[model samples]
Target: MRRTILSSILVMLAGFAHAQTPECDRLCSRDFMFSLDSGLDVMPLVADGEHANGHMEDGRTPLIWAALDPDDEDAIVFTSTLLFAGGDVFAQDSKRGMTPLHWHLFRVGGPMKEVVAMYLGEGASVISKDNFGYSVLDIVNGVATAELYEVYELPYVNDEVADMIRGWAELEERWKDAFGMHLGRDPTSVRYFEVLAEEGYIPAMYAYASVLEKPKVEGFTPDIEQALYWYEEAASVGEVNSIFHVGSSAYSGTDTIEQNDAMAHEWLSLGARHGDTNSQSLLGLMYANGKGVERDIQKGLMWMIISLRFGEDTPDRVRLIDEMSSALSYQEVKEAEQMAKDCIINFFEHC
Candidate 1:
């Protein structure tokens, strides 16, 4: 799924570059030029030192051209060969001042992930911007959407590319400070999350809220009000975990906040509708017990079954399922199963 989206974006970027094949210069061989132009595996040809570092009339080196090729597999070998033969990793085109690393980011192959990493390993600069003042990070951030970032949910993104983006973000002290505490588990750097949260960084908002709600560091006490405030801030930005946490809090009630079943139902219903299984399970329990809304065992069973389908099987869910199943008639169970299936297929609309 991610690869498909990435390929579409890369095609657009490749078109944006609109590069024409360059006439081979005095330094480049026709054979080597053909190898690059045809997107062939370049290892065997570039192994010799003759044309490895050769450039075209546009000042684009063999390395830069390798980066622009649409085929990811051959591009990797092509990049590796040229770099091994001492191709300039920092080589930029005369027209745009874009580095090989920059062009490589637009390559369509998913495996080209390796090429990006290789550039970084060879000390290609992420800070290097093109003529448009767009750094490698800028290009990535501008192209990648929330769906891309949520792939594995590390910090800014999920995969190796995400680590690269985080490295770029770390160039700023505030990000470094926040990530240092959040990821490094350094209690002393906790305040940095507040700094970033104040700046409206959504992840930092979630982190800050968690710390306030349940401080692990010494010399800190839980502050439900502030915690709820930050959680609300993150929730406003569509941070699903924050939505779940807020619902969980309202359901159980904290030191200063009174239990409000209606508010709990409202928040949890929203979270459940958003496909949060935790919310689904809790909402199911509420419906089963008639704590907030009127009791409807079939709806409760539907939610519980759907939660188990999408989320991990917790002891609570397992035990609840067993109890609910035993009490439900066989027809009720089948009806609930069908309802869960419909809810999933219809994306929770009217579920």
Candidate 2:
């Protein structure tokens, strides 16, 4: 990585440092597109960097390239210039029918909010369909659609993103040392986590967020807002543990985030599908009381029963079940019991 940046620097240095240089005429004429991964500041070469809207070999524009990066603050600044210079937020390349949003959502990398806001606030639609009829949320299996719940979040699973989540889990195992190992710990380990978090790695996002919640190191202040923000990052990518936290924590309310039942339900529903009986228990009661969703005694009873089978039949849960059962007809109780069996059999299939 260092070598590539050094080479690009040398190439850029070889040219005269004027307002605009023909140095790129010979050096960069081969490729008009530049990426954060390119590791070189090409801002000097582009005309005001705003008109630097060149496509790469993959047909991706400069904006698409900039979205994939997490570390290059300059790339984000350059993207702002490109946008002001009449850059289209909705520009799609023929390859995979992707926009810059697609690149940002899928790739690992920094300064995510600045880039996301520029496109979103400029009327970029999260609902835009790709060639495959997949929305941005659908492409990632609806993991990060919490923010988009009003327009709605995608739920269909994407195998590629699932595999990526698995890989992140494995990488996390390797970086366990990065958790609290500061100066007394491995500095490289800490850097690895920070880099990955900045790059939008979900697990790393969660880990880093959790750390910020209550800094393990002395003198570092806790930051719940920062913690929740990162948890959202992890939850957006379908991280199961993150889903649990996103739902439960929001529902319970904390100093970091407000109590939001709707957001809680959305996240908990995702968790329940993943066989989270705790979520099922909450949903069971919520449905009974119409806390976030509409009141449905049948659904409430059904979810409660499912929790029972999952070893969550505590005294309160049992009493709630009994109370609801009393209000239900014998046939209704039987139907809800059957629904629980079916849901458990298929891990909440058709749930």
Candidate 3:
């Protein structure tokens, strides 16, 4: 009788342990309706990081998981419940420090936009900074939805919050102007670009230079002088793309500025040293052709190979690399390829 009682007690204890093991996982796997109704009971389970949530997997909470699946109605409800239950909407992922709002803003074209608005309406903090000191507004500013500013405007907030919101709005406007150029909307976008440039937005200065470089219409009636002015302005701000363009323009005489290969070589060298692939490729061409400087086959091959390492591997780059490889011994080409791979690996590892 005593032995049987002890055996029964042990079995009950074992069953209790098994039941507690997946508490968090079970809560997370519950249907969205169940979670919404359970509220605080489910909250403790998520806080412990034992189950999968909307964006979170393995050990992530429902809040993170919901941000990634904004289109799912269940995800939306789960997120709303979590927020109402005092879940940290601004909490970051362990690896990337990305908040829920950050992911939502990045996915603006879809149902995520409405979800983002919902969070903001529920007092979800947008001004929370990431590891890099960038807010959600900052990350999304130049990439998507100028409407973010309007959505984020909250009334009667403190001075600090108000200031942050205003800054985000300004960045959104500047980014709109910058995006317009890429969409081929209008040259008038350059006017806004100039304004942002005057306000010390360095990227805007670069955009203005790009607009100036091309002709307004199809004719040879080029504005080389104006183009040079904007390019120099952008280069003065240390814009890498601007530096390359200015260098190339100086090397090849436009209608206004007389060709000076020496000046071109100088600017191109600056850009290449700064790691601008376009400038590096152009510099390699100059060396290969013996246009401005004395020809050295070895030096030319080295620069061309360097350019190939940095340049995009489009058809043009592939053809250039193949043609340049023909001039070098097999060993040099092999070494260059290895160096390029190493550079790529290092780039991603740090990034």
List candidate 1 segments past 4 Å from native.
1-176, 182-191, 214-223, 314-316
Residue 98's C-alpha lDDT in candidate 3? 58
Error at 74, model 2, angstroms:
49
1-351 per-residue lDDT for model 1 (tens digits)? 000000000000111112323333333232333434453333223222233345545555545555445554644554453342235666666666777766656554333556666665444667666766666676566543324322332123236785665564554446545566656667766788787778755567888889998887777888988988998888765555788777777788866456788988887887777666678878887887787899987788788766654344445456667677668898987788778767754456699
Better of 2 and 3 by TM-score: 2
- For every model shown, what is its TM-score relative to the native structure? 0.50, 0.45, 0.44
lDDT of each: 0.59, 0.55, 0.50
Report how far residue 74 has shifted in candidate 3, in Å. Answer: 41
Which residues of candidate 2, in runs, are more than 4 Å off? 1-173, 180-192, 196-203, 219-226
Return the top candidate by TM-score.
1
Which candidate would rank higher by lDDT, 1 or 3?
Answer: 1
Ranking by TM-score: 1, 2, 3
Q: Give the C-alpha miss distance for residue 4 in model 3, angstroms.
A: 86
Error of 3 at 29 (Å): 37
Clashes of each: 0, 5, 6
